[model samples]
Target: MKVAIEGCCHNKLEEIYKALEHIESVENIKIDLLLICGDFQAIRNTEDFKSLSVPAKYRTLGSFYKYYTGELKAPYPTLFIGGNHEVISYLWELYHGGWVCENIYFLGYAGVVNFGGLRIGGMSGIYNHWNYNVGHFETLPYNESTVRSAYHTRKYDVYKLAQIRQPLDIFLSHDWPTGITNFGNVNKLLKTKPFFGPDIATGKLGSIACDELLFKLKPKYWFSAHLHVKFSAVVYHDERTTSYSESKEMSSTSVENPDEINIDFDEELNNPDEINIDLKDGVNQEEKNKESNNEKTLQDYIIEDDKKEQIPCTKFLALDKCLPDRDFLQIIDFPEANGKFEFSYDEEWLAITKATQEYLTLSSNAKPLPPDNEIQKKIEEELRWVQENISQIEAGLVIPNNFQPTAPAYGQQQTFILQQPFKNPQTEDFTKLLKIQNKINPEGQSPIRQD
Candidate 1:
């Protein structure tokens, strides 16, 4: 169960793979998977660069094109969440989560997937108060404001995570969980990015929703990025009836009735095991009521359920973005969970995926109906294939300067690939994004690979 954690990739896929290889050789341990926090910049083609919302000076085709064009393959299984900087349209296509390329998985906006007996769950994007409650209205041909709002974390995703009953072994967020600054070295951070002093000092540096879930689920490990610095902290939440966080020096030893325990943790969590709000039915009436009443804040949805059994504390780490020798990555291992675990497709995600797929088939005036037997079976097959492959994704050195066949040989399972043809000119600008990626390398001098 060896795994590697990476912070913001910013499309430096080659550097990440190289670093992992170096770690493997030095530590004499093979890393099984590489989990990236965000800003992965899956710009597979020149056309995708046009879709990016970053300033013209910052836009460039990143490492994604190598894999997209089949000139290079991923060296290890890669899993990533979305951050503020991403191609919104492409991710929206598989909003319920899918394989971006062979052995690389995108967790969508919010999702839960099991890997080798480890239940990893997380929500993508940073939180913005203005866009927190808004539906995803940012479509293609994105306008300036819409483009900026595209990556804002929404309440809908947070609500979905709030409904889960199973415990998450690892939780990932693109931004640090709020109140986490209390756990790390703020003075050291201030020395690096002095502007963050106020936010860190005031406990306003990261997402409030992330902090809420951290308390509720209490996952064993919580990983984040977007800050471009590495910081580590431990959250100690022992089994107790009262709501408290160890980082804040709040005690968790007081006992209270479990029935009233959940209601005390913000809004009424109710019976988590029994509260099933049907996705197709749309937003729950309870949620709607809360929303209409005085413009419900993000804090309104931060509910923690009363646990019948105790869960352990979560170790939080926010790694630096991918760069050479900056301590932006780590290699670690975990014990495999006991008993049978479903490695693919949570029941809730399947419902959302099925619902979205069915909605696409109907005309504007038509009422959408669930797909029939044949269609249902096909969906099931696809989900299982993605799940099983991701659960056992391979890690090996990649072949350079090779290409995939347009058509597979007879009886071979079709490799899922996005067809994106673009003219690649061997010019200075092609390596612009590959150049020193800002402040971490203010001198604009990251070493180029020999490839």
Candidate 2:
């Protein structure tokens, strides 16, 4: 189906939707879904602003408040991943990922969601080697130095995606994959932003973990933001199949023998709400045929499933941030699986989350990241746990209780705060909302255990 893709939102929801609506009206085409890359500053209230990791100059309400106040609503269902410039204290609450509102979904720090039978995988935050293997322990009330820790992409999440043998239709990240410079018109890109050349030459442009995933996962399409300039590339995955991975460290993070790759497809995706693909009213029959044939599991499409062919090349697009007259937004078409594919947590991924618990998930006000040695040791331990227990977890014999699943940051649970919100948000009201979130939660639950 035709989907609208935006680069970095920076909380320009109203403008983006307005543009989407205008395009729909003009083209007479019904956009099925809206996918945002990152830098989605979901600053609903002032407390959210405080928790955001952006510099003071860049931290201001764009248009999300109107959506929060019910003054406006997105014209279509929206799905987005997290980025470096975000109110991560709020996102930290939804660690497993959930709907931000009725039609808005966050794809978690690193997650896979099925939309219209399309397996869309995403990695949140930019990758920095210093914080790459560090545990996801950075929490709320972050000081200047500590805030950067919140956006550092962790290896634990990447490890989960790494376990998937099935190919992903699309992948999203806040930053461009490091080697993307090689696939695209890097020389022309330098004309727009010359300073980027130094980083590109030194292989320091984007995330190293992301680069590894691009080569390893071999997704059909990879979309990103952060470098706010429109760029496109086609990565030939099959060209150098053996050398796809340059890093021995990332290549070694495989959970092969321990995982029962042949998971029961029956119980795989029972979560209807997560992957329901309802077609819009006005879509044409021709459009249906063009966009309906999605590649789900290795077995979902039997056309050529028997052979293990080298995966197809990946199309990479990194769009510019949301601003007036930015030539970054684009519309693209992708196939949807003809048959209903189950939408559920990937078995290995679920196992990793359950087994590793807080090591992969940083709770609000949790401890800071451990030192490098401790980080490496913990990662080794987590990997071992996944390798040993993945099969049991897949078979329903093991489920870890240490994980306190994250709560939804929006949706019905948060309607009270949005009830007739003041158009011009006052500090007192924002404070009250903050108190409701942190202190007197009507949900009768707190993220932290009461001593």
Candidate 3:
């Protein structure tokens, strides 16, 4: 089945609409599903950073629902998963007792959905970075209280997935698993002071818990979008066996001669698959090997061929042509360039004529419009009704002229006062505890660490 996956749209409604429209125009294509990885809004909260209890703001899911319901004339279904910035949108839904849209499915927290006989499991939540701060003197537990709270709230999602013993076909999440690309760098940009504070010593990006689960589950495909960068990897596991045998030749022969009732037994044994540990220059050699193997799959071959065929030009071509200064003029050039032609001009008349010619060429072999049958008549009637009631449909939905708010706008300059590290006994005691914890868990647990 074909699907279109996108993320981090960031409330660019026109762009989203254009993307959907383009996808829809692909002839004979059967797009069974649309998956959004999250970050559908430009901002998480209002200008004041205060959560909107109402759903008036375009950032809210309600706004998205209304827009999509009206504009997106898709032939298939769409799914939405939450990202970090979608917290406010989710909050609005929670206040209203969850989203009410029937067509749009919200995979809140984590859930499983079946699409065209394929099972897709989605887990949405940021990494738990609070637990690691317990021992750090630079960032205390109290300072990381927000992180702790968010982690606690999402703890159930972690536990719920642990109970899932069956493997999934596709695993979708907002953040990439640990050790995947430069996710660490992206997470660091989002971390501000006074809330878990920034620790430049360690660059962490992904969730250790999520990584553990991914390793154990071993899904066929995994999708994530938090890093805003494309990354992929294949994990592998290995199985091995060993055998040994010993015999006493002379003694056994003599015993067999005395009593030919010697008995022998053999049994097969199986062991759990053991993954090879490959440590090589900060790269996971085992994963690299698996990815190499994965690249040889049938789908990879198909995708490669599709990519080759989808190129707009069959061959490189460079051509220049000059038109006569007459109203009606024809210029001729070799037609073997194998390039799609597009026209641009410095004058309005030339541009219009070029566009018209291109349009006529495209439509030359197009199917003619159907006759005014019953269905067409009905459609026309509906169109007329829509046109008549357009104003009513637009009631209370008009875009305000001066909607800008005079509040704490985004990107406002702010100053922070960093105090010297406390030298109290409590701080020293915590520092000691942190040293031990750091030894046990050397890797920092956060979305930024994934890099």
Candidate 4:
């Protein structure tokens, strides 16, 4: 299966599809799935602009509204995460993730799904320490603070992602993992964006939460955007780094175990008002960090499964934002797992969601999550429930094609304010399938609770 990876879409659906079409027409190769790193502004109508956190000049309706209204359709099966610049109010409606439009899927604030037999996971939004430990407290009719905080990466999502013990084929994040520069070509990257020198030197360039997930998930491929330069690096998870418990630290307010290695965030980053800055150079650069004593390429240290099958080292790539002549898209083919594959809900991820939904908070207060043993028990129970109740259904694990629009499309004039979140039927149906509470909307009801 050939999949296309695009970085920082900036609401360029039409341009992206056109580029893909040109690739297919010229190379005569078909692309199966389109995975966008972030900045996919899924703005539906003019009302969504109210929650967007960009400068007034930067806020303009892009091509997504056409796709939303079914005037245009996506050429390939697409999945995207959120970034700092997004229709926050619209995205918050389907916080657990749903079809932003037919053929185009939002991966939620953070989510995992199965596509073509590959287990793909993604965490949306750029990381900020001030909001990292807080809950999903931001609501509809957002204020100045909530507008921005609504898109900030939260600990709840990261903790759920951290619970995944299964091996991942691929992982996506909007920001590069902190300390990722250490493994990549720092000198060359600094030469290009010397402005990053201070942050890089102080170990503050990327996301610490992402850094934790990288070592824990240990996916074969990791893709990111946000800093908007095309960069490549390979991370080897040897005995020294694979032990995640030893490499990460947790504060009193954190969700992880307290015994982990300390990854300190600079107190200066706590400023909630700092504007997001991007490097628009769009230059392509390669960063490779090998062991100083004895270099080891990806081939040297293939991770072995219980059956001794080799899994390659994690290959990390961060692409540039979509622009003319920018290195924003790349295509790669994965060997067929089955004759063909369709979109399906990941069982383990579903179990994790079910296990953790009760802890979902709409307050700014930081709370400790359940301990490892308790969480493992809940997951096991939920996993069994999912197998019997969901996976055993006639249609099985395949996702249903039941997308329906809940909001007005662009150019559709309206008199009333969209002050409250729309109770999307897709999300309602999804939560029903899992028998978990739909915590996305305040008024959302769960089948379990209903019963």
Best TM-score among the predictions, by candidate number: 4
- Tell me which of candidates 2 and 4 scores higher on TM-score: 4
Off by over 4 Å in 2: 239-311, 335-352, 355-451
Compose the digit string of candidate 4's lDDT tens values, residues 106-168: 888888988888889999987788898899888777878888888889999999999998989
Candidate whose lDDT is highest = 4
Order the numbered candidates by lDDT, best leading: 4, 2, 1, 3
Question: Which residues of candidate 4, in runs, are more than 4 Å off?
Answer: 242-312, 339-341, 414-416, 444-451
Q: What does candidate 2's lDDT look like per residue over 170-211, in tens digits?
A: 899987776576665666678988777666655666777787
- In model 1, where do residues sit more than 4 Å from their true spots? 239-311, 337-343, 348-451
Check candidate 2 and list the clashing pairs.
Answer: 269-343, 292-336, 294-336, 294-337
Which of candidates 2 and 3 reaches a greater lDDT? 2
* lDDT values, one for every candidate: 0.58, 0.60, 0.34, 0.75
Deviation (Å) of 313 in candidate 3? 35
Q: C-alpha displacement of 24 in model 2, angstroms? A: 1.0
Give the TM-score ranking, best first: 4, 2, 1, 3
Candidate 2 accuracy as TM-score: 0.66
lDDT of 1 by residue, 15-133 (tens): 67877787677667777778999888777544455456666666756667667545688888778999877877566544555556666778878888776677788888888767666
Q: Residue 106, candidate 4: how far off, in angstroms?
A: 0.9
Q: For candidate 3, lDDT tens digit of each residue in 330-367?
A: 11122222322211111211121111211111111322
Model 4 earns a TM-score of 0.84
Error of 2 at 308 (Å): 16
